[model samples]
Target chain A: MKAIVNVGLKQGVLDDQGKATHHALDTLGFKEIVKNVRIGKQIIIELNSSNEEEARTEVTKMCEKLLANTVIEDYNIEIVG
Target chain B: MKAIVNVGLKQGVLDDQGKATHHALDTLGFKEIVKNVRIGKQIIIELNSSNEEEARTEVTKMCEKLLANTVIEDYNIEIVG
Candidate 1:
């Protein structure tokens, strides 16, 4: 089984990295087409467990304990075959 | 329009961050269920253009020119409504 975890900042939180990237894009002549940019982390994990439910549960726990700072970020976990 | 770009290290490239995270997960008692981990970046962009084709084209340029380190990284762009 495999798990994909996407962790991103919540609304209202300032994203410094995103701001920098957006500024860079504007400087590169994309100012006319770009409105805003936000960045996050994508974690892909291969799990030993074959059960989808078990993999999702374990990945969620991992997110809470180590993968994310729950106060500032939100994460979504997807379990795949 | 919105674009979701996932940038990840190509196969065979060493991902130090993922390795560190995997190590931490093992230390936290996930050794039995966690097989491997790979980490990447997800960049979400809001575009001034509403057309999906136009948004995708501009965003792809952004990825190629600024968002992704094309030599070692691979990126996928998804245009969302």
Candidate 2:
């Protein structure tokens, strides 16, 4: 199975990179339609586990232990065959 | 509409960050199940336009110009209400 994880800052946290990107977008003529912008991390893991549940559990553990800084970030894991 | 963009390195490109993370995962005891790991960026944009087609077009243009390094990366854009 494969696990795809998206890690993003919490709602109240200041996203410096996102803010910079938004400003750049505005300057590049997207100011009209671009209301806001937020950026995050996308992690893709190829796992030997075939079971979806097993993959999800392992990936979640990985996130808690290594992939994310839980104090300021939130992560969602999606497992696929 | 909202645009969710996932930008990832092209298959042949060497991802240093991903390699570092993979090494960390192995050291943290995920060596058995963790076959491979890759990392990318996820950019979420809130758009003033409600039209899905328009949002996608605009987001795609943004990707082509600023959001992605076309020579080494690939980006996928999904428009949602």
Candidate 3:
């Protein structure tokens, strides 16, 4: 089975990388096209879980323990088997 | 309008970040649970495009010109507004 974990900064958190990229887009003349930009991380995991529920549980644990900093980030898990 | 640009390493390309994270997971005793792990980036853009097609075109151009490294990364766009 395969799973995708999408992690992003919590709303209202300052994202320096996103700010820099947004500025870059403006410098590149895409200012009028893009209003805002936020950057995040996606983690794709191929696992040996027996079922979707098992995968989701294990992946969620992983996220809570290691994959994300819960204080500043939020994560969503998508199972794609 | 809002759009999401998911950018990931092309298959067969070396992903040091992914490899490192995989190793970390193994160290964290998730080796049996996770077979493989690949890391990627997600860029969320809020824009003022007139329509979905327009948003798609502009976002694709942004990916090709700035958001992604086409030679080593592949990106998918999802408009959400």
Candidate 4:
């Protein structure tokens, strides 16, 4: 089995990387861009759990423990094959 | 309009972060994990283009120019209303 975890900063949080990209875009001729830009991280893990339920449980634990900075970020997981 | 850009190292590329996370997961009591792990980035951008087509074109350009490291990373974008 496999799990995909996406971790991202919450809305209203500052995203310096995103802001820099937005500025660069405008400089590069994209003038109609807006202000809210946020960046996140995705993690794809291939595991060998016995079942999807166990896999989801373990993956959820991983997300809470090591995959996400829960203080400022939120994470979601998708189980694939 | 908005676009989500997901940037990831191409398949078979070395992903140190993923490897580290895998090791950590195993150490943290997840014993049935496999070997291949990949880490990626997600960038969400909000723009004010006149239409979806224009937004897509501009967003694609941005992905090519600055959002993704074209040499090592592949990026895909999704527009969210």
- Fnat values, one per model, are 1.00, 1.00, 0.96, 0.90
lDDT of each: 0.95, 0.95, 0.94, 0.82
Stretches of model 2 off by over 4 angstroms after superposition: none
Candidate 1: which stretches are off by over 4 Å? Answer: none
Candidate DockQ values, in order, are 0.96, 0.98, 0.92, 0.76
lDDT of 4 by residue, B18-67 (tens): 88877888788775665567899998888876588878887898888788
User: Across residues B6-57, which tens digit of lDDT does each residue of candidate 3 receive?
Assistant: 9999999999999999999899889998888999999999997869998998
**Candidate 1 residue-wise lDDT at A43:** 98
Model 2 achieves a DockQ score of 0.98
Q: What TM value does model 1 have?
A: 0.98
Clashes of each: 0, 0, 0, 0
Off by over 4 Å in 4: none
- For model 3, the DockQ equals 0.92
**Candidate 2, residue A20: CA error in Å?**
0.3
Q: Pick the candidate with the highest DockQ.
A: 2
Model 4 global lDDT (CA atoms, 0 to 1): 0.82
- Report per-prediction Cα RMSD to one decimal: 0.6, 0.6, 0.9, 1.7
- Best-to-worst lDDT order: 1, 2, 3, 4
